[model samples]
Target chain A: MSVTTRRRFAAVALASVAVLAVTTACGDDGDEGGSDGGQITLTVDVFGEQGFGYEKLYEQYMKDHPNIKIEERGKGMGLGDYNTRLTQWMASGAGAGDIVALEEGTIVQFKAQKQNFVNLADHGAASLESNFLPWKWNDGKAGDQILGLGTDVGSMAICYRKDLFEKAGLPTEREAVAAQWPTWDAFIETGKKFQAKSGKVKFVDAATNTFNSILMQTAGNGTGYTYYDKSDQFVLSSNPDVKSAWDLTVKAIEAKLSAGLQTFSDPWATGFKQDQFAIVTCPAWMTGVIKGNAGDAAAGKWDIAKAPGNGGNWGGSFLSVPKQSKHPKEAAELAKFLTTPEAQLEAFKALGNLPSSPKALEDPTLLASKNDYFSNAPAGEIFGAGAKDFKPVYLGPKNQAVRDAVENALRSIEQGQRKPAEAWDDALKAGEAASK
Target chain B: MTTNTADRTRRGRPAHHAQPPRPRKARGNFGTRLDLKTSPYLYVAPFFVIFLIFQLYPLVYTFWVSLHNQPLGGEGEFVGADNFTALMKDEQFWNSVYNTLGIFVVSTIPQLLIGLYLANALNRKLRGRGFFRMTMAVPIITSTAAVAIIFGQLYNRDFGLANWVLGWFGVESIDWRATKWASWIAISTMVDWRWTGYNTLIYLASMQSIPKDLYESAALDGASARRQFWQITVPMLRPTIIFTVIISTIGGLQLFAEPLMFSSGSGNYTGGTLRQYQTVTMYLFENMFTRFNLGYAATVAWALFLLIVIVAFINYLLTRRIGSAK
Candidate 1:
């Protein structure tokens, strides 16, 4: 063979290999799926435990439709890492799962980038809107487009140690406990009383939680200032509610009411097991975490009470189908199915995640159910009542950033590194800066 | 083989040069003959191709992104030099720079000193020499993430073994994460623990290469082991020390995982509540992912690159100066 011909052939072969590799690495854009062979695979990506009986629901769904294969990728890391990974995937326009979980704090940010997600309303998502909480349904909507399906709502409650309350000569009854702290100031007063009687035990787990609960309760109230106004201008520095929450949290820290443990830390978990704190600012999902950490030794030692002041929402998540998914229809179907009233109820019963579906919230079976872990606390009713009082707060695009800044400021106070006024100023400055 | 001789003959070889005739075999297939000159280029092309696509492309793209008001997953507006100006005024950027330098000094100094000492000790003939050397490398093989996690637990203010030990001396528990210096010390402990052994191994290899004759002469002249280490070992190991210093400076400037994991795992990327331990890379990661400020993150990346280059150059000059003085 001529040298030039051999050289040309070699170059062509190398080029073809490179091209093949590039194409394969980019992945298959399977725009269509066939039901003829009764086979389709769906991948779902979630952070932490989907705790929502998703595995069981997926199993049930796959059994009913034997042709469909479902693969779930549980990141197990917390929400921050999960959101970061999802954002990277979305930006790169590849390697995204068919369905992804979006936490409420980050949902607004994702909603702003509407091009990355499929408008679920185009695929009959609107028809199921009536099935979910109105606010939750709206949260998943960006204008007319429904970007996600509501999965769970994190209605806030207070889980207190009944034995510890008795030890401190405070009321042990759930109703009496709830009435003692009708306002945040009353709660702090109760904490002081408890502290004077009880030796070293703290009234609350962390001041940061107090800050978040109070902020969520007051941010969307009639006040004109919240994280942002209607025009999306940052109002953190001017927000009266933010100032109040920060001040109250600072008071709690100074009064030594907080145990100063960062939530979900190993020490925090240890605090639960050891009963180091009297009360935990319990979001609906936090019940699972509490129960998991408290173990069998602490069973029936804890009880549920109403959160101080007006009710607030702490956490919740939505299932979003990315536009990059090859099986968009199937993915949408799975997302809708996972969030259905029955599925949501099952999840609530199996995991502690509160149901976002209004119908599921009203289910007699769920309401009648009691948890042995919390002295037979009617968790469903407590969370349901909390859920009812939860108003839909408009979370700005930088909501997580603002929240994190404030939380860090609260942490500094809890650590005794900064005074309330100084930390408050720092927090406001950081929050405003982050908003920009 | 036959083609090379044939080509040489066709090109007219020097008359004085003697050549052996090679017999040509029947060409059965196109694959049988190989182009030796061009084949080496083909063999080494894959690494360069992959490097260009994966490394160089992203680097150039990052520089381009730095010049714009890039938001994640969105088209960026052209805003040349604006991001850089904003970064200059950003207190968090300066804080990160300070924290990174603080941690780099705290970690690298102790690490190099202890590493040098350990290498010197290991160089001595002793019982279980192989075992001791192998054990020294155990921390190096352990994953950085795991090391960070274990160190985090150990540094816990309330429950850690460190505070537990301190309790024996009537010392109150130090809030490692809250205090600026304490947090740096905690993070430095993590960085030092993970890397000291690796540096020890490097120093050990360099120390082993140093002529035994120099050490013997020092010993014969009544010089102590310590003096030998100072006078002969250190000077002899200058180039290796320089290499490790350069590598450590680059690694320290890019310190991310230790501080990230140390500060409550993945949730708190600011490194601490006060960002007392936030490294430059952590700051870059925070802007890129948490804040979704891609342009700012790119700017931080460029700044870090510049810092590393400047520090490495300073190190090169210092090493050269020392070498020349000797």
Candidate 2:
């Protein structure tokens, strides 16, 4: 062969190999991963164990449309790993799933990176906005445009040990427990009574956990400030409601109402099993955690009660289509299916993630569902009622840090490193410092 | 044939000098040397090429990001040096700095000291020396996550083996994650458990390399084992000790997985109930992931880099002084 022709052939072969290598690195979801006729595969990444189940849902959806297949990836929970993994994926603009789950605290930051997610309004997501409650629906809104759709609404409730309550002579009946605490003062008095009767068993997890949740539910989440507003500031320091919450918590500690176990630690779970703690202030997802940790010892030994004062929401998640997704339609359809009333209810049964769909709240399947884990407490009815009255709170990107700082300050008081007054100052200082 | 030879001479090299055919080929080889240098670069360029694209590029990109105000997921505007300025004013950052340093001192010091002592003990004519040496390394091979989980269970306040053991000693139940000191203890236990064995092996390796004649000379001079350890053993292990210190410092400063697992409770990412145990890496992670503040997180990473550089510098100075003094 001529030298020039031989060189050309070698160059072509090298080019082909390089192209193959690039394609291999990008990964494949089988040409049929998407439901649409496009060869591109759509993936939706969500956090928690629910990601596993979503894969099945994706497969089911793909069965109907052979051309479109989905690759579902689960990014582990908490704001730490969630942001890092998602950020890396988003930056790559290739590996990012078609749908990405953005948590409440992270939504603002994700919204700021407007290029990462596809504007659903552009892809017929506008009509679905009205399906959710105004506040719940507004969580994913950066402005007029919606960045995500809420998949679950975490309405807060008190999950107490029925056996512990029974032993403490506090009413184990949900009605009786609900009636006992009409106000925050009444709740503190009840806590004192429970402590007096139960001795060393802690009435709740930690002063910080109890105080923060009460502050949110009673005063409403970030009532004094919105993160977006420059004028909005952390009022947990000077706010009377926050002060009262702190005061009440201190009084509980002084009264020796808690077992003093670290919240979310191995000991904490063991405490639940041993019936060492009476009450756990939980949101929607915590119900599953309670059952998982307590095992059979807690079966038929737990009951649900209204959160003290008023109901406030804690955690909920959202799924959005990234702008870089190859098949936007298939991605949206998959997102919609995963969050549909039937699917959400099934997920609720599988995991205690409360459904975001308002229609699902009225579904008889949910209402009739009884958890053998919580002493056969009507899971659907109790969570559904709270879900209805629950209001969505504004969570800023700095919310997690603020929460951490406040918790640290509270720990200072618990450990006797600082007094409540000093801890309050520290918390405010830390929060302000973090905000900057 | 004469015409072909003339053509070959012209194509292979300039024939200004009339020489043997072998000499002409040798002169042509000089040209091939230049081509080898150029062409080999093309053939073996992928490693350097890929390294620049993936590793070096991201590192430089991170430095670029550090200079800007990037939020989580790259949404924020570039506010030059604002994040750095904010970091300076931020107490949490400073607090984290203290936590990082404090953890380094608390965990790394005891770890090295105990490792040296254990390595010395095992070096003697003892029974089951091989068995003991192998057993010492078991902790080193164990996963950090698994160690953290196991220790988390042990540190449990209600029914933990630790608290139960403490109960036998008339000690009251102490909440491990409630206080900063106790949380550090919990975190340090995990650190100490995982790293002490690895350090011991290094110390032992250095110890085995020490000449027996030196120890004999020390003994002949009537130096006791303790005296020998102080003078002969310690002085000889200086270089190894310096190496271990640097390793421990870098590892210590970047202490993330242990404390993170402790905080998350479920091995998730929440920084414990109190966040008393949260480190700088955890804070950076939280900022980047939980908060989606990429700019803030990048700022944290750069600060960590500077801190690590400063730490490594200080360690080098200290080690150099110690080495010279010994």
Candidate 3:
């Protein structure tokens, strides 16, 4: 080709490249000002069944406020994936939902990076503080700023098959059954008795939940019953509560009280239906899972009792408006509305997520309600009492990793892969390594 | 022109007919002219540009990140070779490397043998030829996640088909995820199940191209079918075998999804309770995502890259030596 033609071709290519670059650069400014006709779409990212009640809540909210549109994105893979995605979005400073749900496990990690979320106190969240439980409300607070609003609290309870208990010659009544195990030692003894009589079925679904329940109970016990201290130093190795919990879990494993299944696993769910195990360490939210897994055939066979030892909290979540949100005010308002007493009560009734709001707990309808799935057990009373005693555990940035390490130790013992002492050493080492 | 005349005189051919080449005019469209010059590069530029942006940039950036102490959401501090130094002392890192190699060996050997056997069977004159060839690709088409989940159930301690089948022969049930060897075996079974059929197709494609006369001569020499296969088919399949080995080695070193899925369905990427089956990729994922240690994760990535390069080089040397010996 001649020089003129080559030069013309180069010019055309350069012009096209410049056009592409300009368009691409323009495309990246995001949907910050994309709203048309004063209408805004707020995206809410959540994980698992925790987001179950939001669709109805969003529909109701949209009906009330026509100018606002809410879009929900859910990851059913559970909290690990949800937290990873949230962290990634936060790190990239883009693609984060207007509002994101943070589980109790990872909320502190997000709270540590306080700038990632908008201070809801600046957007009228402080006025609603009296509506929520003090600990649940405080759990969402970083210093004077509220980063999130409490949604649900997972208060501990013992879910057992009444018929299975009867077969095992144990007390079938909720109060009597709860009376049999006031402490963990008593709980272990009761498990022994049940197993001695009922050879076919184990006492608990999995020892891992028992370990977690004990850990939760001991975590906020005012002593150094924590993985991290107030200064966020690793104290897992020196924590007596952790050691005691490990010992108790080891004892349970040694006694063969566990059905040797992982919680939420397919086998564990199937075991629930087949009555392979008589009991499970149920938090308030687990009642829903149990009911779903048990189906209609096992309907009133299951009952709820007070959890062994002092009360503990399992899973809970908070809703936070990200700083990247286009409409922070609207997102905060939606978050506030979702955690309101009325909304919490409705959610409790529909989804079995125990209310985090103190006023919702005071509501006579919720307090008097019985779960027919749990043999008409007064679940409200049991979980409410548990929630009342729920002390706020100061979870460190690596709480989930630490918890996994401890739980992995318990699992190894349960699987007969390691002795308790070796597992304990392994847990401490792993916990320290992970925390670092 | 002088060189051409000299060459024609040396060959004692007709020098008059060997005239200087005529100048050809630019013909066809702009595409033909462009192809003759440098413009063909423009056609392939998109792929190279994309590769540079996506693959090459991340790789170089990963090496840069490895020199820092970056935590998620925290501004990384420059730490020089500290991350690599820590990796050297990290037991989990070495454990992962060991697990990866163990899984690779267990998976690859059985996969190659079974694939070779299947390919030989498929290359014969058989009924339902098309159907059998198509069936060989079924496993390759299935998603790895689905395969992992299905295999997890089949390897479950109390309820798996494997344990039940063993029970019939009076063998005890094995907790596949609890022990190192058992976990390796379970993960290997998953890897082999997915890739054996794919490798079989590869081998069969190469096997079909081999001259039929070689096998016929062996048959005429009174060699047994098995002997002829060993003598002729195996020798001709060396190149394809080497290619599969390299491919499988690369794939096995980067094994991630099966073990991750096999461990727990709820996104626990530790590989197992004890991390008995945690391959190197899973370890990197655990460090990067779970622990939020980006710097260390990047170090692991670099280590994995170096390991792959070294292994691939050794494979090349071994194959070349074998080819030369033949």
Candidate 4:
């Protein structure tokens, strides 16, 4: 090569070395819990856009307590990635949260390692128990110890488009719809009727929602099983109630009541907005989803009725102080304050997250409140009625996996990939794997 | 010009003699030899140091962790080989293995064939060649997560452009995520989309380096385009093909992001409606993250390592045999 060419090559090599040096210098140093000034750097982790509304709430809280400042760390949506990120942070001795949010399904998993979280029973939550529904309260309890405090009660109710129901010549009023389908069988029949009327629309979002709502109500428990008779060996597999629920799901798909869109998808959201489905089994938290997605076009066109089955609790969250927390007392105080009837009521007004506290249900504010999002429906009154009746149930450590397994099995049947019996067997297999 | 070049060469030769560059001592000192021996190593040492710290140490630690029952966040027991034993008996693990191998075979074969074809097509003089090369790399440069999301939307049963196009043939909209095989097709489409261009570029590079004389000779021997490809091009490109195959196989088998993101926005991690699209890497991720079973996940990672090693070894042997036989 010529001398100039060689010189150019050498210069390029030096530039490449410089680039590499710059990248290495910029690599993360793995710092945690850095605070600026008097403000505490509380790394509040939530999934998806959950922190958006909570950001507003925190702003209000900061206004009241200007001395205490908070920072938020939002991660991936749903339980899977959320659990993963939380576990990683805690495992690295990063001390994840002073006041951490725990999904209803994740509470048992977190409580399994009690040392990872502070027992909220120590933080005066024991007295607060009487304020919450038994089931919502037990979500944060392990054995006799309370590790988290419930922020919201996810009481299941069927959300139906009033306009769609009216067009179908079915009852558009909440009370009438609630009375029209006291049982799941009648509900499916009503769905058939609704489908016959609306040529383009479906009766429900998917078969799984219909099946799970009934399952949760009839079982009257958190884990979706009433009881295990022998040595308490957890009779989820052969439970007749669960079997019936599974069968009902398959039947719904066969009967064409379901829209066939996977739940929580973009299509499902569109279905909600367009009222493609006549009924949706919405938990209290779903009020936020409905209001956010359904838009003004759906305003005053929807109302909540009793879910086909009796009142069933579906989803709720808890806030807990981990034992590794530097300021456990302050954390516990924060957790306690977050779940208090007053605070929960405020959250309910802002986000449509029903307060788990029963006292919050009886509050004049709850009784008087109306949602402009749901055709100005008195949503609080409707949800509060069911929220009062939620019976507490046991959720074992493997609850999330078990629920997923059952959901998958039911989905197989619903999607016509397997026969009902084969689906049942699949469920058993999945449950076995999950429980192991 | 010739006279000037000659004068420059003469000056360069005489200048070397006139300068008598200062290196006078020839000493047989141990320190000098040590310095000579170590200096070259020191110059190239960073890679080894980085490889040892980041790659080798983590792999060794992962192996150690695999031997125990380490749950997420460090609550575990030392259950020697129990995780491996459990994995052996685990049906989900076996299912994931089947899915991974299935995806690997399904994705890599088409990717290689299409890449080779595209490389051949592009090797010929063509219009907008620069733009075509740039277009080919666009997919590879795009984020995997973003690719998955776009493909997910395209594969949507209700309103996807794919299903809309299929409607031209009077085909029904397939619930891509609802069935196992359909989900595999969707995921394979994603994998093929991202890496086909990359493999094509590799093939094109190798193809460009092949001498024109070989093809000219083949044409002189009454060879057609087809014959030239099979006889001269294929044989000469064997090593590049092998390299591409091995790389593609490793990537295809470790397919996680496409399936994970395709199956995102759902409550379950079955990969698809029936758990049909769940690759082994996804299984490992689920074990570690979703189930909080880190020891089991580590075992899974080790098993995956062994799998890759065995497959790669077999591939290497096959390639060597082909090369040697030729």
DockQ (C-alpha based) per candidate is 0.42, 0.29, 0.40, 0.37
Docking class of 2: acceptable
Candidate 3 C-alpha lDDT tens digits along B1-326 = 99998997878866755887565665655656667786778888999999999999999999999999998876899999999999999998998999999999999989999999999998988999889999989999999979987898898777889999999999999998889999999999999999999999999999989999988888889999998788778878888888998999899999998888786633366777888999999989888777888899999999999988888778867765543454
- My TM-score estimates for the predictions, one after another, are 0.90, 0.83, 0.90, 0.88
Winner of 2 and 4 under lDDT: 4
- DockQ score for candidate 2: 0.29
Q: For candidate 3, give the lDDT.
A: 0.85
Please write out the lDDT profile of model 2 over residues A1-436, one tens digit for every residue: 6999999999999999999877654544444443333445677777753342454566677776666657766644544455567778776676777888887766765666776677777767788865676677887777777788888877878888877788888788988898998876787789988887887677887666676677666555445333223234555456665666667777766666655555565666677777677788877777877777788756887788777666677677888888887777768777777777777777787776778788888889888987777777777777778777765555555666666666666666766667767777877776665564
Model 1 per-residue lDDT tens digits across residues B1-326: 99999998967865545555454666733444566566888999999999999999988999999999888888999999999999899999999999999999999999999998999889999899899989888888899878987888898877789999999999999988998899998888888888898999999999989988998888999999878877888888899989999999999999988888876633487878888888899889888777889988999999999999998898778776543464
lDDT per model, in order?
0.85, 0.74, 0.85, 0.77
TM-score of chain B of each: 0.86, 0.84, 0.87, 0.89
Q: In CAPRI terms, where does candidate 3 land?
A: acceptable
Candidate 2 displacement at residue B130 in angstroms: 2.0
CA displacement after TM-score superposition, residue A173 of candidate 4 (Å): 1.4
Fraction of native Cα contacts reproduced by each candidate: 0.53, 0.45, 0.47, 0.45
Tell me the deviation in Å of residue A72 in model 3: 1.6
Which portions of model 3 show Cα errors greater than 4 Å?
Answer: A1-36, B1-36, B265-267, B321-326
Q: Clashing pairs in model 3?
A: none
